[model samples]
Target: MRKDIHDYDLSRHNTFGIHATCRRYIEFSDEADLIGILASLTEADHPLFVVGGGSNILLTADYPGTVLHSAIRGIEPMPYPTSADDILVRVGSGEVWDDFVATAVSHGWYGAENLSFIPGEIGASAVQNIGAYGVEAKDIIYKVEAVEIATGSCITIPAANIGYAYRYSRFKDEWRGRYVVTHVTYRLHRRFTPHTAYGNIAAELQRLGIATPTAAQLRDVIISIRRDKLPDPAVEGNAGSFFMNPIISRAQYESLLATWPVMPHYDVDADRVKIPAGWLIEQCGWKGKSLGKAGVHSRQALVLVNRGGATGADIIHLSDTIRADVRTRFDIDIHPEVNIL
Candidate 1:
């Protein structure tokens, strides 16, 4: 089925909770419905924006074009060789991402446990390549099934063709607004291999006195860690991790390290390193600081929160201020991870 509304209120559609609306909002629950809706679209719906779960966007103003949301839902296991150690499962794009991860762990499926509580839907997971702990969606994704917005033809794109990178995919670049994802197939392990070294997972596990943790145990640890750090969107109107950690040259890292002495970094390659944007933001004194109605999240500097009734422009202003500070102080440029419109 499909639901089409004109001049739709989008405050609930976006996680930022901005008071905004679009010229049109079209939601479809199945492929046929999506195809039919697309076929009937007029020139009024020329420009389109696709959103999933609304956890990764910041709406700045009333949109002048159509906004498409997927309501398609399902999860089905695909048959594979009985002796194979890994299993393949097909999931609807509209399925809640964390719910899928929970189900996977419940059924003894591995590889997704480390990504336990990240927000957004399965479709957006592929689009954003959402990651947590040490696992990215691309690590388990096998193929992506989508509909070409222009041709209205179904396309099954192999994961190898997605061009996955840190917090990005082709769906966000050259393929932006070109396709609507319908389903994603993931290759999951039947055997559990724990990824506990990244972040504080190992420490959390050790604190719980679990040397060899189960999938469920690991998932719980990740959930607990995230809950302690990030705010709930329902209670606080904000998108998580407002900025992407900037990657810089090794020489640049050394120069900054000499000045700060306590700078933390991760190796991206021999010549490049990824610096934590949150650390930089904190050093600039933005953490827990408010600019107008927008503020940096008190616990995690990477997040920007709606202190109350903040407009999209307010959030942008806060982000801009922080970006300028970081640039001036560290000479490292940070970019937003959230999609802003």
Candidate 2:
């Protein structure tokens, strides 16, 4: 357990690079350390917020509560039963997500290669149901290990019990701030089942003159595609996608399609259709536009970048303006994927 700091700066902790401070910040390096910290804070009055990787949150302002971070790190491949064709790997919550994906690809582990370069840590993956291309975290997650915040008891829950959906999980809902995730177990296949149907992975690979893409090739292509579309947080402060693609009824999509003939959409189900939020923002003429130091990314309108010295409010204002315009112009409501703190 690290000594707590008072008024700790969080500019570097979050990907948006917001200059917010917390009243108290504590970091635990391992499960034992985390248990100790939780036990110590049980009688304390300040509210607790646990964060990993800091990639999915937008700090709106200085926090008045205690902030918790887990630094526990490791990835261990567990033995698989002879009857099963899959392998189970247990990972610490603090391990970098991309690094784990890279390791899996190198060792011929499938399923996660399509999720190649998505940011955040292993712990946040299940919480956010982080997905890319055609794959989501929920698909491979076998179980999650966490410590209850209230009682400091460790519990292992099956992935099915987490109530996962597109970009959502129970961790973000009823269980929010109630547990500190310690480890995640993923079931991956020994065979590489390439998924290039979503986005431009297939076309991009073809453009690169590759007729058949291996697991590593697919991973590399996905990383390249993301790099071209999304700004690096190190260079320009931004989350990958600021808005969740709005899902509407099929009737509503048909109504909009009649007005905008070139609109792109996908069927979420028999009655629901999903439209790209980026295309909607572009249609509203907000792409590459800026308000103060916040701007829509030139390459991808779904990303809102910090044009240096941008505060949380600046980004929020820009998002609000875009949301209102989208609703007024298309009668669709686009919500944010980034968690606003």
Candidate 3:
């Protein structure tokens, strides 16, 4: 249930296709194995990093510490539902995220359909608070089960205490290196309530002649839209949505709007507005452009690609160039969504 290797090749671990290695690599398939491995660790494993699916990270150099990955996998529906309208399902951290969405949709479960096709794993979903369309993982997450890395004690934390925010969770910040997520429980609705108002979902449905879409149809529409915009990591090396959309004050947004007159924006609240980072990048003339081996994806300017043999540094360079330009032109700073390590 556990495999430990020294001086491990990590090229296949990350989606970026960056050639890198680590001091050690450990994969555990169950909670007991994880506890045993943690108990046996020495100072050699000083700085440990946990990765899942490796879809949202950019490895900048060879890691000098141990890399932990979860191989534990399963999906189980909890018996004795407390609510007739909803059901709770527990999913292993190592399970592919999209696969879980697919299963949920196939079984007539709602809530997760809006997040269909987003990459990464269930564990990463809880950590990243992954969202797409209009729904975030926090909206459906009932609880998170994890093991404290220091004490190897299993603990279940409810969603309310996780401090969920926009593309963020306590796990990514103050709780970093404190625990490794093993499973996530989600509350799904039995009655299908499709959220098609956000983005182009409704428009796409209308174009396809679907007035009332089933969960499967909605998922298909989202997948089609994503495929049209984002490049496959398998075919081209890239982290999806390299930048997080910048949220600015309403006054700032209004001032910028006066000059551009047609700038796209989303109202975050009464005081703030979310500006699309892709639109800003494209306006700065980085879309479909290249800096060495790293380039901006033509369709989705938010994505930075490894054109062929791009290194992590090459991607960083390209990102830096775009960030600088965006700052100079708009007086706004855009940050990367992908973790750089």
Error of 3 at 204 (Å): 1.1
What are the per-residue Cα lDDT tens digits for candidate 3 across 270-312?
9999899999999999999999899999999999998888899
lDDT of each: 0.91, 0.90, 0.92
* Model 1 spans > 4 angstroms off: 81-83
User: TM-score for model 1?
Assistant: 0.98
Please rank every candidate by TM-score, starting with the best.
3, 1, 2
Q: List the residue pairs that clash in candidate 3.
A: none
List of clashing residue pairs for candidate 2: none
lDDT (Cα, tens digit) per residue for candidate 1, span 246-334: 99999999988779999988888999998889999999999899998999999999999998899999999999999999999998899
Worst 10 residues of 1 by lDDT: 77-86
User: Each model's TM-score?
Assistant: 0.98, 0.97, 0.98
The 10-residue segment of model 3 with minimum total lDDT is: 76-85
Model 2 regions more than 4 Å off: 1-3, 42-45
Q: Who is ahead in TM-score, 2 or 3?
A: 3
What is the number of backbone collisions in each predicted candidate, taken in the order shown? 0, 0, 0
- Which ranges in model 3 have alpha carbons more than 4 Å from their true place? 79-81
What is candidate 3's local distance difference test score? 0.92
